[model samples]
Target: MTTGAEPDHGFAWPDVLCAPVRSLPEHSRLWVALSGGLDSVLLLHLAAFCHRSRVDVHAIHVNHQLQPNANETEAFCRTQCAALGIPLVVRRVSVNIGQAGGNLGGVEEAAREARYAVFEEILGPGDLLLLAHHADDQVETVLFRLIRGSGVAGLAGMPRARPLAAGQLVRPLLELERAELEHWAREAGIEWVEDPSNADQGYDRNYLRHTIIPGLKARWPGLARRVRHSAGACADSEFLNERLAERQWTECSKGSRALSVPALQALTVVEQKNLVRWWARKRGFRPPVVSDWSQVMHDLLEAAEDREPELREEGFRLRRFQGWIHLVPEQPEVPVSPVTLLPGEPLHWAYWTLTLESVANPESPSRPIRVSTRQGGERVRFRPEGSSKSLKNWFQEQAVPPWERACLPLVFAGSGDAGELIAIGDLWCSEQYSGGAPAAGWRLVVRRECD
Candidate 1:
């Protein structure tokens, strides 16, 4: 049933919720992100009346702390949820305006990031996240991306349904218009707050909505419907492109971070960019900007064999080393100073957790040796009596990239930078000092960090 007057008895909230519930799982938690606005108010009310046998319904309100009416907005959400007999989850999030937390793009973008971060956290495996984005919002998004020079990926606009984190996010009301929701709101006698900032044309989306979209719609009636159609076409194209890219991505992928440069170079430039973008997506990072793709193609792969070019953005560095282009987080400079590592203890350093252990060796070096980054020129043998090799040679032999070698944790037997090397970055434990055997298990494990 449509949420419009075209229905025989006019628009109804229960009708709205029941239709969308068909797309949702029969047994899962249903969370509506309610902002106490007209769109969300309508959605929340409708969700409260949804069939409880199919899914449990809930509401979430994120307080960005940006507006002066933040407390009132949250309080309104709580009151409304209470009246509807639905539990509300209110999260108060800090919107940083200070130096470190300030907008890398714009304040709107920063607030959006903070809001989505909270949304992703509240969702668990198979949970359904229902958003109140409507047709007008979809038009605004498509226009914003178009004016900002987006490709098919960006032009695809907000999907009606997509998987985010471990849960599924569905925008059930995307087919409905804000005016229709408002009309229903008035008939239902539901109160909703109007965000004052929505009127401020200073924001890009607001500018497009108030100025550009209106002018365009005046010139071309049903512009929103046309734009929505275009977005659907773009989404279809992206789906097909992703299917092809996934195959190429699997073939060119070397490990978690590295891609086979030769394999990438063999593909057409478009496919290469698609594969790289897909790789970035797999790593939960944004793909490279369209503006940077040409330079990346020329410098990273097409350049001379000896040339090592890199591009860094979004905390990840896409660089070419040896025979591959690797996508790894931009690492801090390897610590020049030595850090003490006590046996059977873990030390956190540079996006990694380094743990060291030692056996009860009577003839071996004492416990609590110092650890530092690889400084080159260091020598170590697998066994105390085995032949020694430079740390550089050993790293090369182990296929560790030069950039990675410096960051691998190096454990020493003594204090200061001059300490004798005992354990090398969770890879090797020196023979004589080897936490030998299962009985004398001295080992170090370097864990890749997620947080």
Candidate 2:
């Protein structure tokens, strides 16, 4: 066990709570993410000691089941909270860490997902979730992201506060060192659980904390503090990047959801790349390498307007159509068939399907039409008096996006082999076929759309 003499002018529990609470609302309920560790124990104790009136404190402990003593850790947290007269919420989460990515990243990410899920469930609207991450953790996180070739945003490490589902998550001790939390816990006679995994060198974080950080600290005793400052600078730089990205998005975006091709092409190459990266990030897509962005931009901007340009990277497809770029799934292409629909059955398409049923006739002439992909040299005869037109030419006339033209499901009439193509969904229909009057005749009814 490590022990140290208390500092003379150190900011204690009351001082920490009072400083942050002056800005918060009067009836804010703060839930501490207590992991039965020194940092969290100290945080919980501090929250209880101060702000007991205006703030309601609750402790949440998540059992990841990675360690054998996870149960003991939960019991210790419960006991500690009970002694402090604070309510304790224990959540046991089982994670299949091996199936995610089988690395430390996978394990940590799965555990974190489970932990946050429980935290969100316990917290109500406007309640705050307080985490116990400290300055040393922030420094280590920045180093880790740097080694992994992260961008400025990732190298900034964790934010002090962020909005979550139920409320906001705040890291109060982000300015405090880890050693200070241990010192405070010891001074208050608080017992904390020690997980053996923290010392295990197999994990990258443990290796950094136990081996790399100690070596660096030996050379420069304030290395963690310096790295924390560096992280703050990186965060400021990232904020500028974000602001520029937002501005680019405003200039380049078409609708509320997508970017306009002409607007995107008008920008410089660097601005175009930034706009694409920003758009991907905003749409919840993972950031890819510079090479990936290069290919996407080249395909989107340099490819021929009539050609369907698609580039697949990192489980997403950037596709170019008639003056537009759409992000879609990079899943295996499933072949859909143009077949006559039977009652109470579903027809499968690229990502969605259509179901047919019997229904009464409405105001307009309701028609049963077989929708299918446009076949080469296929001509649809509208009515006995109207002239026949090529399906491809008709699609172009309707201004349908070029990429979707070939994949549109074709609908026909009658059974297996004796069906004539009638109507294509949102494209064209044979004027010869009409659901006139619905008197015992086959009426095509769109049932449900499936993905």
Candidate 1 residues lying further than 4 Å off, grouped into runs, are: 1-14, 26-28, 53-55, 98-105, 215-222, 254-256, 290-292, 333-347, 355-366, 412-423, 426-437, 448-451
- Position 250, candidate 2: lDDT: 70
**Local distance difference test, each candidate:** 0.76, 0.70
> What lDDT does model 1 reach?
0.76
**Evaluated with TM-score, which candidate comes out highest?**
1
Per-residue lDDT for 277-362 in model 1, tens only?
A: 87788777888886767677878887777777888778788888777888887786656788776666678766577766555533
Q: What TM-score goes with each of the models?
A: 0.83, 0.72
In model 1, state the lDDT of residue 296: 70
**Model 1 steric clash pairs:** 382-431, 383-431, 384-432, 435-442
| Position 432, candidate 1: lDDT | 45
Per-residue CA lDDT of candidate 2, range 190-216, in tens? 677788678778888888888888898
